[model samples]
Target: MFDINGGELIVLFVVAALVIGPQRLPAYAEQLAVLVRRGREWISQARTRLDEETGDLGVDWEALDPRKYDPRRIVRDALLDEPSTARRAAASAVVGIPPAASAPLVGPAPYDDEAT
Candidate 1:
């Protein structure tokens, strides 16, 4: 995230040395390294925990990404598309049948007036 070039880094080191004094600059630098290492470790652990928690959810990354959005295409697909593979799998599961044995829905659904 930082845009520090070689020159800028050298300038920062010089300033730190001047303010903190060269006598203890090495000690301070080592402390800073330890702090940075700890921050990285914390972030890594957090990411690992988050991954473990959400790995089973099967997130649909592309569907939520605004960069690939096309309003017209989205509307068109929603209006005209047949059930997708995921939808079919879900339907099959709801019916307690294996997907391979589940038949595609044909024609209009039957109505049971008494059930309603």
Candidate 2:
């Protein structure tokens, strides 16, 4: 993300070594690693908590994905309804049954011998 290259990294190491001295550089590096790790953990925890809180609200996370926001994808999805949903609606119309009432068509067995 930082776009740092190998040359830049070597320069940074040399400068750090000169400024911090070889004596304490390893210790400082370890501390930096620990700080970075902790920051990652904190960020992960925050994301998990946010997801959990939103889970109950029936949010469609895929709809919120940045990649799906492309204008082409948006237009495509808008112009073409999901094929399965369209078929289900058509079946309901032909059968004179509401979509909910036809849930058994898509779901597991609705009538069990034990229930009968």
Candidate 3:
């Protein structure tokens, strides 16, 4: 999730190398590798356990996926929708709810240059 670039990564590596001496760096690296391996194993186990627990819930996995909760896509779909029927539009006006429409025109525009 970090937005680290190559130059920044090199700087980080140089700083880490300077802080942690070369003599002990190998040992620390080995420990870090082990920690990462264990963390991955723990995550995999947790995921499997979760799947086993919820495997029979009849869940629509794709529908429930977090990635599908996109506000832009929802708004695009809403905006692209055609206008409602004439009866429904009338009902929406009566209910004070704006109708979902594509460039709906109310009536002829009032114009008078001398009114101002």
Candidate 4:
């Protein structure tokens, strides 16, 4: 997340080594690792607590998941409700793209061995 490249990491290491000194660098590095681990644990605990509190209020956690923003899911949900012809025609007027002649089939097509 910090986006530190190899060169940046080397620079950070050199600075830490110079400032902290070679004699104590390993000990300091170990301490830093432990601090980071503890911080992560605290964050996870906070997230769990928040989720539990929100769950009491009946939130749908799956909908909050960022990975669920799949294009297929979005388009499928939008198409499930059949809009009237007037709405469909007006939609293109706002966006300036021609409406489809017809909606495409939502799922897998029938096998066509003849095409293969």
Q: Give per-model TM-scores.
A: 0.56, 0.49, 0.50, 0.47
What lDDT score belongs to each candidate, Candidate 1 first? 0.88, 0.84, 0.84, 0.83
How many residue pairs clash in each candidate at the backbone level?
Answer: 0, 0, 0, 0
- Using lDDT, give the best candidate's number: 1
Instruction: Provide the clash count, candidate 1.
Output: 0
Q: Which residue pairs show collisions in model 4?
A: none
88, model 2: CA deviation in Å? 17
In TM-score terms, candidate 2 sits at 0.49
Which prediction has more favorable TM-score, 2 or 4? Answer: 2
Residue runs of model 4 more than 4 Å from their true location after superposition: 1-4, 56-116
Tell me the spans in candidate 2 whose CA falls farther than 4 Å from its real position.
1-3, 56-116
lDDT of 1 by residue, 15-113 (tens): 888999978988988999999999999999999999998787877887889999999999878756777889889998998999998756666668999
Write candidate 2's Cα lDDT for 2-86 as tens digits: 9999999999989989999989999999999999999999999999999888777877879998876799877767556445777
